[model samples]
Target chain A: MGGDVIDFYFDFASPYAYLAAGRVDGLSQRVGRPVRWRPILLGAVFKISGGQPNLNKPLQGDYLRLDVPRCARLWEIPLHQPLPSPFPSLAASRAFYWLDQVGGEHSPAALARAVFQAHWAEGRDMALPENVLDVAASLGLERDAVEAGIAQSQVKDRLRAETEAAIARGVFGAPFFFIGHEPFWGADRMDQMEDWLQRGGW
Target chain B: MGGDVIDFYFDFASPYAYLAAGRVDGLSQRVGRPVRWRPILLGAVFKISGGQPNLNKPLQGDYLRLDVPRCARLWEIPLHQPLPSPFPSLAASRAFYWLDQVGGEHSPAALARAVFQAHWAEGRDMALPENVLDVAASLGLERDAVEAGIAQSQVKDRLRAETEAAIARGVFGAPFFFIGHEPFWGADRMDQMEDWLQRGGW
Candidate 1:
């Protein structure tokens, strides 16, 4: 458990997850733990958890529009206007697993950051496979391999299994983290997470 | 706008609101603003916002059970086990408005803190009117007048109106704060709210 990596569960469609992605590396370095970047489909997780997108909730939707940018500014992370709709994160998420399987230890994390930046920071349309491939290609991964990798049934199953496994572990939201068996949710919880690591639970 | 007091919107049933109640005073002092403690019915607000208690959601409910106590420990606030069910907060919420109407400037805020502590810290059942009155009486308010105050139609109307007005202001949850027109939600957001007040928005 001492050497255990922090499991970071995220959805590419989530802006909070995007924000968490930007800061998690620094958190990892400070805490002396590697992060296991696990990209899951929130739509799938929400289906079982009876949760929905905050963007579909009444007041919460409006708050997100204001808070996300404010948080980005405060954290010094670049962010553009949100997509007209949530980016269809299926391909991007699948691409992450594929990279994790074939690439080096850090490659998947690098790709995750790139994909999050493309959609959130640069306003690229990640719903398009071409754009997702483009982001992966920018990371120097072969575009054809990424396209093929995402289409694999095994890769699809891995994401499905991962999302279901996250639900089994009581994760219902993006930007969720696990330090050993303890769960921490949301980008806002980074401070608490830091404290948890520093004090080993207060 | 400079002279405007910060508006603190809350419900007694929420542990997060209980946590916020403890900290809001220091926040008010540090920001050089008074806080208008407005007790609200999150149940009514949820009806409009299509939100429900975090304790009613699946995985979220489980997370709250662990997180609340952990937060209480981290914040150095005492917390016993939560009530078997949520504390029915209507009568307590009404008591807050009634106290605000007739008590001294700090009395209602004092009552809010006591009620939160009684329920959350001491494991008292705030669902019972007798318990709420007892807590108020302990604060030097006449018990008979407190009982009469909570039972008054005008006080009932005030609570209803405040809850509706909070909904109108897009408050979907407990521990919502407004600095002028800018809104902040959740106990977790206190730091962000403080930053907003000190920097006057980033």
Candidate 2:
């Protein structure tokens, strides 16, 4: 729980999480803190947290259709809404954990951004194994090993375990962050989170 | 639909709305836009929007308990959690519409701030009619007339009608704002709201 480490939990399907992913790494580096990117299945977290996905709410769903693009434009990130919106993030989450096993300090982060960009930026179907593998290959990771690793029992178990662990630690949403056990939720909270770090928590 | 007007929809019981209420006036003045403060019941808006109050979710409730105080401190506002949390805001909303009937450019705005302070700052029981009347009286409005005005059938109906109007306009949460029909929801969107206003929306 050192001040040098920040824990970031996110899901591939969340637009806000995509937004946070783009900002967290740079902010962490600037603030001289290392980030642990813990990719989780928000669907599972929602179940434990008694929260329903925003996509399931008709009004919220419509609002997000407009909001996501607006936010992407505001943040200066290239985003295109996926054809099949709110697709399963399990495979992508699994890829992350699999990559974490062998990747160095920045490899997992690179893969994380690639996954977010593949789905949200390029509108690629990350739910598809081939698409995920294609993204992994684009990141210069071995394709056969990534394909095999995602399908591995331990990798899938690790993703599940991590999601449950996040729930146990009171993570109920995507783009949830923790700096020394102080929780900051949502992409909108990035500025406040930075301020908290600067002031050493008020 | 003039660029000079910003429509602000809020509920008295919402903590985020309280935060927004504190800042919207100054923002309006700075940006040279007029604010139309429309106080509405979030409960009524939620009924049609298929949404529930955030307090109903245990995890979110816990997060808000801490987040509210943190935000209050960050914004340098006086905030004490209301004695009875999630108190009925009907009387307060009705009072606003009643005040709107006779008040000037800043009357409704001032009353909105006073009501928010009475509940969130002084920890008053805003659910009680007497408390609402007390807040109105404190604003230099007549005591007996203010009490009678809040109870007027038209005042009650205006509050109800405004809430329905807000729903019709696609407002699903408190602290919802609009600049010429470009909708923004949540207090966290305040900065984005200002950006949209400044840039005339992207």
lDDT of 1 at A182: 87
Residue ranges of candidate 2 with Cα displaced over 4 Å: A1-3, A81-84, A103-106, B1-3, B81-84, B103-106
DockQ of each: 0.64, 0.63
Complex DockQ, candidate 1: 0.64
What TM-score would each prediction reach against the true structure?
0.94, 0.94
Which lDDT tens digits does candidate 2 get at residues A53-164?
A: 7877878878777677777667777887443376788888888888888666447778889988888888888889899999988877889988888899999899999999
At residue B186, give the lDDT of candidate 1. 89
Residue clash pairs of candidate 2 = none
Residue pairs of candidate 1 with colliding backbone atoms:
none
Native interface contact recovery, model 2: 0.40
Flag regions of model 1 displaced more than 4 Å.
Answer: A1-3, A82-85, A104-106, B1-3, B82-85, B104-106
Q: Residues B98-174, candidate 1, lDDT per residue (tens digit)?
A: 98888674478788899898888888899999999999889888899989999999999999999889888878888
C-alpha lDDT of residue A62 in model 2: 80
